[model samples]
Target chain A: MTVTASVSTVSSPECGAGRPDGEYILIPAFNEAGKIGEVIAGLSACGYTRVVVVDDGSRDDTAGRARRAGAVVLRHPINCGVGAATATGLAYLSNVGAVAAATFDADGQHDPRDLAAVFAPIYDDGADVVIGSRMLNPEGMPRVRRIAQRLASWSTFLLFGQWSTDSQSGLKAFSRRAIGTIQLKTNRYEVCSEIIAEIRRRKLVMREVPVRAIYTAYSLSKGQGFTVGLKTLARLFIDRILHW
Target chain B: MHPIQWIMLVFAAIAEIAVVAGFRRGKIAAKGIFFWTVLWLLVGLVAVWPDSTYIFARWAGITRGADLVLYLGFLAVFFLLFRHTLRMEKIERDLAALVRVLALRDAPEQTNQPRADGDK
Candidate 1:
């Protein structure tokens, strides 16, 4: 199967034949009281028919707001990591027989337009997994995210010998293979890095597509603290070195 | 060797085991594991001690083992909430950033609440 050239459109198949990759937009949110509504509406408008918001125990109104935005809501009742939330979302989609599942951030850095890029390869059966990369356009990407992406890329290089441009992009599309093989266990932001590590370890058919990224003051404020970066390092240690 | 003391010992043992089980089962996360493991050890220690709860209560200036029992059960709920609060804070921060990104892009707000910080 040939990889789709780009994520240019959000058009659906004329019919859902033999479970033709039912599209589910999975939003795993923690607090996200500010951005979830528009995310749900945007994906819905952008042609995502089923949107599932997993509220990872936000003390705020993340779940309530998500429900208001026409998404099916699942609350964690306490804070689990984004990894856990994403795992929950994947589990649900798999259980219900979703053919294709796209994970979009509740925090709003992703362009729904890029969904096609992330999923097109998987949608066309060319790759089992698709990752979005801001690294493709370095000048267009912001400085802080560039730093994070580099860290993600290099760590993945060290782990799997697979050099990914942006291993940590929140936007990813999965084929049934991804949903089944990549077992996600981390509950924090580090899970983004962990997913790529798993992909490299498993040697899954993976591709990175250039996608547009949006960075705003709010996202910057929420960007990982040094401790989060440290946590990512710690996970690398635990997973690769310590063998814990 | 009285029947009541033996009964109390069995009850305490069961309670301590339950606390350990909760930790093992991950009815709580890491914090849960650490807290309950320490607690279960303490309960087990007290259960095997020569002194009874009545004597400890009178001498130690505390109540019966009921307090200890209640503490173990309630700890799980509280810790779950603590982790939840921290998770909420982080998510709120991420959402705020994402919202600003979308808002700047001129996308519509999806929440019933106003555009500014909701629920702090």
Candidate 2:
């Protein structure tokens, strides 16, 4: 891909040449002190120096670890769920004039190597929103998670008439325009479907990129169980009715 | 009408009148107050003539008028509870958002602070 000169002007020269202007990698963390530092370091090594970590009320030293690893840490006084953390990070990025932002999971499940591919479309201004879809390859993804994600994707399609292979993927990249226009209200996992709804509602161009999710015992344990999935479904239904 | 039924009817009538009077003095919307007053008066009439419920229930394919009222009441209560839960969720989300803003705004940049439990 040919690097656009305008895009080159906005990226940090120290990280990688031609990185999007005001681009930042956002990680919303909760009690992942053990993994937060590695997540930040991985991004930095990828030539993406602009990193922001929203420590979602972790009782551990997640905030301190992230800061030490060269990340701008934003702390939430209490756990506000992943959705709220992502929103806080996005709000901060927008305030700081970020041209694009990518949200990465802090559970050590995501690969930092995919950051460049995820942000490529946004950097080239080819898409307004890019979602990382594990279903594209489904390698290393647990069977339960794969099933849950498919069900969630089907439900999201039913609600928003837009479908993605992985609607529940924790990784997504948003252009500056998408960040400024898409306002998220749901503060939990339901916010993932809400984003799809917003993309449909605002008619924003969305692209799904094939990405690998390395689901280990720790990451698998942190996923939404059956009960949480039910609650999420209920909330989404209520929100849909209210919007109607 | 039976004596007991008459007493119940009179009590319901009085209660409706009081409610209407309170609505007039309260800040409730005029349209809502009027609707409630009319509903209460109708309810009073039904209470006085319990037999009417049987007729209505039969028309609605229910076994008894009392059963119809019970089912409707349950439905109303469930609807109200659902709405209340939604409202409460909204308030909680708003509070979280406020707290998040405050936290971010007051984020500590001091990296030299000693870890109370290092590598524990």
Candidate 3:
């Protein structure tokens, strides 16, 4: 497939020459045709060009839109969960010899401006993984979401034995070592907590940066509901018992 | 024999016949046929002699044969469910790996190249 060109210019100073050469932004999307293009465009507008979108068997034109928005699109033939998509993206990045990689949500909840901040610790501070925490400055976050995020963080700490301000955050940067070392087995939303477990087991240096979340109605609707959260918790518990 | 014992015996006989038929038709492997045959034989034995379980129940310090059977049934169900879940998870992981490999193979040739728009 031919890669399209972004019309916007790189205006962010963070996207200038000092940016690492082999850094890539990985976006895991499932039926996100409406928002994937805009997310890619936003990243492109911020001058973050090395974007890879793993289309998780989207029935809509998600892959097409991402390709049109100037992203390297990787299409899964079947509908695997976000965890599988992220793992696929990481494998690709590792195979391509990427220096660093950051995962961005295709639902447009994450801000493109925060990409630099997320990657800062990886490059500047030598962190293996940098998580962009919305809880750090959750000024405008909805009450229910805030509570849910806190509960998820607590559960992740209890189950995986790692504490984070936002354990389920989609915005995370990984260094090359982290990318090659971390192997994901879980294929669902539970992968977020599994990543925390990996951080502890692999002894990877992890840091959290405060990042703003753009919580539109659509974005909010796309997030995990009560049933999904319960299922995620159950699967995480099963994974812990079986694997750990 | 009690009416319930008669019904269970008939059901076990029918199941055993089905298992034999499956084995004859080559639909079931030798190991699977052996397992099912043995399981059905045990079921028939229990159906024929419900009081036989009471001896084992007493040996295990259980009060009632029915209670022992119920407990064993629950254990069997749970064990099968756990095995099924593990098998399903392995299949999912295998499928995900296959999909990932296919996606990687089909990725764009210009994956690492700078976009033509000079954004990089």
Residue A182 in candidate 1, Cα distance off native in Å: 1.4
List per-model TM-scores for chain B. Answer: 0.38, 0.63, 0.84
Task: Please give me the DockQ of candidate 1 compared with the native complex.
Answer: 0.02
Best-matching candidate per TM-score: 3
Better of 1 and 2 by lDDT: 2
Over A1-244, each residue of candidate 3 has an lDDT whose tens digit, in order, gives: 1111111111222443335678899999999999988888778777788888899999999998888887888999999899999999999999888999999998999888888878877777778888888888797999988999999999998997788888899999999999999999899898888888888888888888888899899998886887899899888888888976
When sorted by TM-score, best at the front, the candidate numbers are 3, 2, 1
Please provide, for model 2 over A1-244, each residue's C-alpha lDDT reduced to its tens digit, 9 standing for 90 to 100: 1211111112212234345547788888999999888877777666667778888889999998987887778889889888898888877776776778898899888887777777877766567788888887687777878898999999988987777778898888898888888888888999899888888877787877778888778887775788899899888888888887
RMSD for each of the candidates: 13.7, 6.7, 6.6
Would you give me the overall lDDT of model 2?
A: 0.78
Residue pairs whose backbone atoms clash in candidate 2? A10-A21
DockQ per candidate: 0.02, 0.23, 0.49
lDDT of 2 at A71: 79
Candidate 3 ranges beyond 4 A from true positions:
A1-18, B20-35, B60-62, B114-120
lDDT of 3: 0.85
Best by lDDT: 3
